[model samples]
Target: MAYFTNFKMMMLFTLFTLTSNAVFATEVPETNKSNKPIPEATKFVTQHKGTFNGKNLNYKVVAGETYLLDKNEQPTASIFSFDYLVGDEKNNRPVTFIWNGGPGSSSNWLHMGGYGPKRVVVPSDAAHPGTAPYELQEAPETILDITDMVFVDPVGTGYSRALGETESKAFWGLNEDASSIADFIAQWLTKENRWNAPIFLLGESYGTTRAAAVSKVLMDKHLINVNGIIFVSQALDYQGSSPYVDDNIVSYITYIPTMAATAWYHQKVDTSGSFEAFIDASRQFAVDELLPALFKGNTLSTAERARIVEGLQRYTGLSKQYIERVDLRINAFRFAKELLREDGIAIGLLDGRYKIDERDDVSADPKTDAAKVISPAYKAALMHYMRTDLNIQWQRKYLNPSDPALSSNWRWRTAPDGVSWEPKYVNTAPDLSYALRSNPQLKVMVASGYYDMVTPFFDAEYTLNRHGINAEKIDYYYYEGGHMMYVHEPARVSLLTDTRNFIKEQLAQNSEK
Candidate 1:
């Protein structure tokens, strides 16, 4: 996944020329060949029965690879997917394609923690999940009863890999990634003869970015219309989420309400007021007061600046002096470190409920993320489940977070045509708007976590508010946890229920249409 400039490519070519002749002079050793023929695609199927939402459910799991082909129809890459089809009602049942973010991540997180039938049990209150023998259980809250689910792994993730002479980097950019995934979806629908089935997409974090772009691809390139899209911990607009940048005004405005919610959670802010009311106040202050003061820059009057600083202090639970020193713009990372400095603990950016005790307190950013405390348990659980329960026996390693090379080589290009490509903060809201316009029946459900600083709930609202999106077609749901909000049992059940309801409503509406 190494991204190389023209200069680097030329240098590598020259180095290869200098060394190739000498290296190839040695006699090559011959290897034995097996007569066994290689299969074009890998597939493993298993069946199971379970009770969900008071109904006995029977489902089949198809864990395998689907090859993505080039223009010549030669295999380019093997994209891995776990398809869970419920009952024999395949043609009419809704099908939801799900994946997590990271640009390089596999579908493991959402597969194991969110809506899959099998889930890893982690402490709900953001405590450190130590070592293994992690509890893995059947999640009755899964949406499998309402819709079939397919968890897909992109190229260079999970057991997916480049095939033939194709390079893995071919599917590493924004447009390339979306197009390949759309192709996989199209291939899957055709193979299963489920093209008439309602199609929904569920994506988390950067996967949300992919979902928006992929929706457009499906409509324009493949002539496939999406029924709905679900965004879990949405990050459709990077500029709003990236609070680290000093000059990102939208980031500052979008993050204030989340900081206020975090402060309320920690009991640092006054608890006498209702949480919802406090959040509304914070939102108002951000747009009406804070944003104006920030726009004024040095032109702001001393009294006005003082008023804004006081408002920030009250909302963020930081001292007025501290807010003034930072010029009223709170960097999320710094806030994580400074929030509970007196208690010798730093808050997590993903989940502010979790705290970490860094060795040194003076660091600008927290040493580690508190939300990652439960990651080991998740990894162990997924590996064990895949082998023991799902019975997926593969020699290749299952990459959890991602392959380093894939991420490093990932291209950030989002341009649709031959426009001058300049890498900037990725925003796919316009793509989503286009999808909505093209597909009138399409609806979107956005799930946000109160404690998720990485993609603040406010940012989700802001990103969806404009961009020509119909307000009636969108629904918002909020949880009491972090980015991977489903790790919390209550939130998990709530999310599943809300999503199921949304799907049912969408189907009913589509039927009437």
Candidate 2:
């Protein structure tokens, strides 16, 4: 769940190996038709009524599998999606396609915790959500009243999987994953007869990376134009988010504000001033002071290095010795463990507010994410809701994160095999820039959490602000919680309100055209 840790490093390493070897399997596997006939794509349709934003509306929930085909029109994979559409008005209303990240994730996190009509209740105060029987409450705050929703679980996650003959690894690469999602969107639009409706892409974490790439694919390949995109905890450029890597100067700079925010949350830093002001100062210090000192490396003078170390200490609340020990570049994971080390507690990387007392306080980084305290509740709620509420009776097991093979086989190479390419951070911000350039009317809303160490708010700023993206078309919204900011009540309400308004604003602009 954290950045470029072992799994991510393996992904990167695999890409490097593939590129260096300059070899790939050029043959697409034969269509999988075994001794037993492939089961028909399963689907469950249910009708329900609810009050959303004070408006009583009846909606249909279509939870099922959509087969993705090869160029020969043979089924290659099945993508499972949950479609929520207003009664009979599915074609006319705006539609937003949503997914969570993991590169191998199910859409369940955003589905159950953020935008779903029925959200699983967890402790908003960052406490453990305790055992099961988790409450499923009506999320009237969701923006469903204005837009039809499609929550997609990419292949290898949820009930989605590779069909006969096609291997799951076929959809486990950077380009492969985005292409499948784009294909699914086109297929969904065709099935629902909603090609004319305003389309939006909403993705969180690595899903944000998918959104940007998908937007470009939709425009360049499908001739489809998205009206807007919402990036929840954006990770379009991995360089800014990959803090675990050594000598990654961008990460050192990008993570300062987040560390400052975490320190402020734990009251490790001086908190007398406005939190916003402190964050602003941290951002400035990162760019103006720390970045240059880190860049100077061994050339930096002792006096200047000392001043920079003091600034880091002031913002990060880490001691001078620790700052010097790490050579003034703080690894975010260590910060999470060190911030509350004396108290025998480690703060959560996903949400700094959550703290756990680990058995081995000696570890440099937390063994597990403390913020994952709510995961069990979310998992239970989704499984229960699918069967009981959505009537999804399919026997297939739902993979929450993904299949083990997905991560192992995941490819990150950007170029075709044997193209003489070098490994680099996986970035899709340029794709988003291309999409914006192609569709002049398209705008983006970036929602970032102050406490999200996984994808820092400052990194979001660092990413979108560059990449030739138009600042005027990009709107930024900040939240109080971490990666899944909606877990915080106030943040959840504000996120939905901001989302609702952003969609409306985009639609309004469409009308004037």
TM-score of each: 0.92, 0.94
- TM-score, predicted candidate 2 vs. hidden true structure: 0.94
RMSD, every candidate, angstroms = 8.9, 7.4
TM-score (C-alpha, index-matched) for candidate 1: 0.92
Give one clash count per candidate, in the order shown: 1, 2
In model 2, which regions exceed 4 Å deviation?
Answer: 1-36, 89-91
**Best-fitting candidate, scored by lDDT:** 2
* C-alpha positional error of residue 317 in candidate 1 after TM-score superposition, expressed in Å: 0.6
Error of 1 at 61 (Å): 0.4
Residue-wise C-alpha lDDT for candidate 1, range 195-268, written one tens digit per residue: 88999999998889999999999999999999999999888878888877899999899999999999999998
